[model samples]
Target chain A: MNREKVILLVEDNPDDEALTLRALAKNRITNEVVVAHDGLEALDYLFGAGEHEGRDTSVLPQVTLLDLKLPKIDGLEVLRRIRADDRTRLLPVVILTSSKEEQDLVAGYSLGVNSYVRKPVDFVEFTEAVRQLGLYWLILNENPGRV
Target chain B: MMDRLFSLRVRVLVLVLLAVVPAMLLMLLSARDRRDASEESGRARALQLARSVEVDYMHRIDTTRSFLAPLAQVFALVPNLSNVTQTACASFFDKLIANTADIFQVGVASTDGTVICRSPAGAESAASVAAEPFFTTAMNSRAFSVGHFEFESVTQKPALHVGYPIIGPAGTVTGVLYAALDLNAISTDLGKTADPSVSFITLITPTGTILARYPNPEQWVGKEVGTPPSLAAMESGGPGITRESVSLDGISVVSATVGLANAGASEPGAGSISALVSVGIPKDQVFAGINDRLRDDLLGLLAAALLAGGLGWFGSGVLLRKLQLYVGTTRRFSEGDLAARAGPPYPRNELGALGRSIDDMAVAVSERQQEIQRLNEGLEQRVADRTAQLEAANKELESFSYSVSHDLRAPLRSIDGFSQALVEDYADVLDDEGKQMLGRVRAGSQRMGQLIDDILQLSRVSRAEVGKEEVDLSVMASGIVDDLRRTEPHREVEFQAAPGLTVTGDRRLLRIALENLIGNAWKFTSHTERPQIEFGAEGGPGKPVYFVRDNGAGFDMAYAGKLFGAFQRLHAMDEFPGTGVGLATVQRVIHRHGGRVWAEGATGQGATFSFTLGGSS
Candidate 1:
């Protein structure tokens, strides 16, 4: 196997996380994807603490997909933490949520998340949202100084 | 006194008397004059009868003298012894006596005063010879003479004697021819000349002796003429007449007398005889004619007066009765009974005029009363309608306030909750610029939430139904100040709350009002070393007023007018954090309790807010 690229998925709902991973595998952008469930957990994972300790530091994720509502913390906090850290400051962050609330979108963009996406109520539209987010973060956009 | 003076019946009666009295007086005076005229007429009639008696007596005497003159011619012829015949003298004398039957007797005597050739031969025995006044007077005189009146022997009635001398050829006395003229016969004819209403004729000798009287001849014949002044007056002069009241036979008589003289005598002579003829009207009978007339006149006057008086009284009564009815109706109308009306179907006169006016007045009064009633009803209806409109408006305002509170708070909560979540979770992913921006957003959302709460509180004040309870305004104010201190634990606020400042009002609303006022003081005085707020009672008992006063962020008094308006902030968010709706909500709460709120301040000095919850302490 070629050296596997790592992807971080910051989602709170377990059903949405399973659907997003399935859409990435069908789109043939299957990489070593890690799930954090909340902003606090995502931050801990990136900094390698709690369950993320002893993981290879050199193998940081190429992109992160964020949900706005989460347990223990929220998606916007996770994105803010990611952009504030020096190691993950330049990393691409995508905001995803089932809510169409306007303030959440504006707040996501204001916190320097690369993109914002709303999870649709229909199953097909939700799967398409996951597919587009994975392709843009994993394959389409070239992250600088990345191997 | 007023009742007597103003009585209507007295006025009517007085007016009736005023009109009737004069007419009655005139009738009485005319009746009296009529009676007097009738009495005077009776006296005149009696006097005329007396004059007739005098004329008749004198005429009979004159006729006898002429007869004797012719006999004297015959005696002269016999003395000359020519044409002397006994048959001729006897026949002529008989015819002369028969012709002078009204005379008592007619006879001729020779120059020796012996009676001869007497017709109705008994007359010689009935007549007196030489002792007769007429016979003696004729023998003594050369001319014819009339004797004094006397009662004749045969007739036993009043008689007047007359004598004529029979002279021979050289005018010597040959015979005295005498005749006794019955004065009663003349008086009987004179009585016929006057009405029988107590008229009497009397024949008297010129010596004033009573001779014959037509009425009561036997009784008056022998009496002297001194009783009636008229009898004495008749003997005084020739053809003189006088009127007098006399007592004849113990009965009062009104009489007149006239003197009788020989027909050819212009001067008094022994050969000429004068007699008095008097007529008397008994006093009762003299006035009897007038009495009848006066009685008739009085009766007529009484009837006329009664008729007039009755008519006047009845007319006045009818008029007054109608007038009284009208007056009564008018009185009732004046006392506010506009429906009062006069009696129906009266005469058409001045009283009718009054009735019509009263009826017209009643109609006007009824119309005015109806108009007043209609106006009152309309006013009541208008007031009811306005009250209903005000109630409806109050209900609508309450519902609107509830909607604003509920709907506005929900959205603000969502915005704040999501913004807080965004800052906590997304801080790691944000750059310095990003983080700063997020901090601003979160601050804005929190501020917005506070603004919504303040606005909702203002709305609640405007629309809340005030619940009444006895509230201790000073304790409520102090409690609010303590709560505000806990909200900002580092802020220092001093409270001077008067104890036992009780008020009757909505406790919840009053506490809300005081909380806003004191809370504003707490928030505005965050920069001050010590902030002071006061709560106390103002004014007097029964009208006691509770007021909350604050010394905090004092604003310009020029702008104080806007202090109670919603969202009117005197301080910016950076200078003093507030939604600017606290004082507005306080004003609305105070106003809902029928109180008043005001503020006084300058730009750099502190603000003092004062509010009154008007109620009994």
Candidate 2:
């Protein structure tokens, strides 16, 4: 039996978060989905802070969806912190934001965020964008030391 | 003086008087001499009558003496007394009768000097005496004795008596016989000799007795002369003539007196008894002939003078009329009537010359006027052509501006949209480097779109009509700064927006200007630890200016002049993300509202953008 992989969704907009979850579901990759409201909550779940405590880090989510515009810690800072730590230095991060600003994309890529995505304004096109991201990062992609 | 001499009337009058006045004066003087000669001939006839009277009287007296002498000789020879007396008386009476017809009266005295027989028969026996003075004076002289003139009883008239003494046979004492003669008949005959035009002539005896005068013989006969100055002057000298004023027959006369003397008498007293003959020509008759001739001459001169004056006046008027016509035409031409020409049929003189000059002047003036009219029309045509060309050029420029603003932006937008779409749709098919390169392509496309937009906006500002509205610039600047802070929330920026700054301009356009200025501030200050921006107004009234100041990567002031030019960039693309059309757009917006924009900056210190919107209220 093949064990299903979990994907972490870190997005500020509810619409974008739902679109990404629907794309994974439509692709038949029924993995466990953990939703974080922003970059701060995603960090908390990884570090076992206030509301997300005592989480096992060895069974980490396969990929995190980080939105650039978050409430407290921005997506780029979260990505920097994860790349600086040895335990999550190799974690897969995809930057998903509504802005097509170049500075944000460059800063996100330099901080070791694995992929940068601009959220589409059209809902059908946004669903396609999420579908392609899921197929490449989860189905067709390979990560090291996976059980 | 020239105006006076130029008159035609004066010239004509001078010419006429010069030829006519002297001719009339010469005719008057010659007529006066002819009247004087006619008066002198009357005086010469009176002198000839006086000489004839004297010659006839002397011959009668000499014949009487010879007859008496012969009778005395016969009486002495015969010695018969009765016969002798009868014969002597008969012979003497016959001789007296013959002589009395030629003379006035004749008388004979007896030879014994006692009695005389007179030819007039009444006086024959009146006196028979030998003691009478004529008998005594004749008996004592050898020649006949002439007695003094006296009044005679026989004729009752003035007479001269002549006596001859009788001589004996041996030439001893003898009887004297005398003859008596009346002088009035001879003087009466001499008075008839005067000419009728001559005045009365009077003959006077030397003893101042009046003899006879023409036209008044009865009043002057037997009257003694009253010793007139003419008579006194004639008595004082031989052959003397004098002019004297005298009263004759109770009429005043200027008488000329001439003394009558015996013929060939040179001695003072040798039968040279003084007789004064006076002939008078009155002054009225003497000058009457000359005055009639002078009156005719003066009338002729007056008529000639009037004729000359009339001709001069008519000639002058003719010349003046021609001159007045020429002057009137000249005046009309000077008053801009070039068509005015002189009248035809002018005189052949200076007036004709003047008319020709006026016609020439009119021709010249009309030609110049025509040329000027043509030049004015040409100038107006040129101006109209120029105006048409400008209008066409303006229309072409308007369409070009519209195309730049509306059409040029469409392609840039497509490039940016398609590039952004590639990154979003094809992100999985690309590797990391390919994705990164696509990101750079999208970024470059977006930047190019922004640059096109900025350039289009700049063009639009220059082309658009400015609509004015009151804008609170301080608030607008604060709002823009707030917007910049929110655009990139990580940046720490300080804003100092001055309060109470208002200007009248297009609010939307001014907003664009402020946005560009503030955006530049924000972008350039990105490298600073604490970015600061200030917006305020400075300077006084009539020169109030607004400024945007930033602590940023200021450019060198040497290249600052190019800041407001379209697409002029100062910083490298990696340092400042800009199309470099922001300030150019600001400049265009300000200039559209009739204002100016400029920048002041230095390398690495700060930059300030100052502009004027020509504040309207």
Candidate 3:
């Protein structure tokens, strides 16, 4: 177990962010979560630029839960930028959006997302989805360290 | 065929020839008749001239015989030889020869063939007369005899000698008295009355020797001629005979001949004389007048024919020019100029009527073309406007669907999530009713979210582009049924699908249609003791009617029409949980593929939903 395993949550809606955090906590996932209000903030936290300046640029999230609709740069553009960079290109990204639109799913996958999961309106289903995502990426899925 | 092969000019020429040929033939026939009449007239004129010459010769011969008969009587009365008798006979002959114009000489010969007396005494007045033909003929027959033409001693001119035998009182022949008739006097009398058309006049003896001729008589007189065989016809002495032959001078003439009968012979039974009189009209003079008329007539006919032919050619040109106008108009029409016409300056004839008819047809055709063009333009504009309106409606629908997918679901998620947190985190303070209310709020918010999702799905089906491929509807139905079974493992639903339900359509759209139809059947059949669902096809190839049938909670047939309408539910939510949008989405997919969907049902019995894809199976 890597004690510094971090989860990135990119969401523009405060209510959805709160719901997602509660869902992860309820699933007993104890990894430190870095919350970004929008696509640009998520990119800033990962690259240690903007408000996250002077931070360790080498540190990357274990998994990124991306929302498709966000303020500033959209989720698809942020994912494109993440894949474009060598440090974050191979980072595990799961699209956790309130949209089940096929266009968003296709665009998310086309931009090199690791998984696409639609956010369920049922709170229980949302909690179960987060728990499975944490188990698969933080524990069961093999990761190249520091890549 | 003739009209196609020949032009209008040729036809007109043919018509002119039709009029000309028979007219020329008739004129030629009349000209031939005129030529025959002229020849007949020329022959008649020659025969008349010949008859006139024969009459004059016969009258002169009769006159000479009358004079000689009386003179012979006078000599016979003084038969005894005496000098006084000879002198008296000589003076009497001299007085007789001087009184008569035709008689040039008179002489007396005794039976012993010596000249007893002579008048107009010449150096050869005592010449022997026994060798004279007239003297010998008169002594043998004792009749008046006509002699051959010879030169007289007294006159030295051609003359005919005639002799008379004197009979003594004892009824025996005594001496012969003869007279020479001057042929010049006879020829001069004939010449004064000769017809101008007569080219030559000839007098011939029985021996075929010409005694006298009028023109150039010196060359022709005393010459023996081979009498023309045609002169034999005149020997019968009925009428003169005319024949066309070459004369002694080699001029072609139509000659008429008449034989003169012997007259004034002492014996009544003396052989008849066969002296012939011939008059010749040269052939050039015979035909000259008629030929002139014929030449003028032929020239006139030729000029008329030329004038008619020239007029025909010119008239045909005028007619052909009128026809050419029609041809040019028709050619322009074929080249797509519908406005071309053969009219306005029309001739006042049948051709003008035809031109007007052609112009009428052109006007109708041009108007019809313009009308069709106007219709075509109107149709194109309508189609363009309809396409633009369709595009705008589709754009509005797309944006609306996008908003439903993204913004509408977020609030539902927040509502349900917070309700869940209340129920979970505040368990001790919250009463069971409070927790139950939170659960109800969560259910309502989740149901609203599901409704939004269903609406989005239906809109997406409407907006998505349909792609074509072969899809096995039966296999897809089976797959959907298997999924239903997996989702509700405890439910004992009997699902059966017939195989080989294949069709050509958008595979993804058809799959979505099939899922909804079969899913509806599955959900409707859940409460039955032995729930049954079936997927199969009916109808024929290329237009197969597919159906999903269920034997579960069936609605009344009265509400069947509303089955495919969006949000029109026949069953309550408690009985069958749905957004009531599935059938609408299925209907949209079927319609997008150019098909239709319908449902049939009876209360407490069953429902069968049937559909067809456009023209593929």
Best by lDDT: 3
The candidate that wins on TM-score is: 3
* True-vs-predicted CA distance for residue A56, candidate 2, Å: 60
Clashing pairs in 3: none
Using DockQ as the yardstick, the better of models 2 and 3 is 3
- How far in Å is the alpha carbon of A84 misplaced in model 3? 1.5
Q: Is candidate 1 or candidate 3 better by lDDT?
A: 3
**What digit string (tens of lDDT, one per residue) describes model 1 on residues B161-268?**
777777776767767666667666665665566566655666666565777666666666766765444434443444555455554556667676766665435475
Q: How well docked is model 2, in DockQ terms? A: 0.02
For B535-590, candidate 2 gives per-residue lDDT tens digits of 98888866788899998999999998889887789888888878878888888888
lDDT of each: 0.68, 0.69, 0.82
After the best TM-score superposition of candidate 2, give how far the Cα of residue B468 lies from its true spot, in angstroms. 22
Q: Candidate 2: where are CA atoms >4 Å away? A: A1-147, B1-91, B94-102, B110-115, B124-151, B161-182, B206-208, B235-255, B262-266, B269-272, B313-342, B348-617
Q: Regarding lDDT, does 1 or 2 come out ahead?
A: 2
Instruction: Rank by lDDT, highest first.
Output: 3, 2, 1
Give per-candidate clash totals: 22, 8, 0
Q: Can you write out model 2's per-residue Cα lDDT over A16-127, one digit (the tens) per residue?
A: 5655676566566677889988778988888777688787767677778887767788778889888997778888889876555445777988888889876543444555
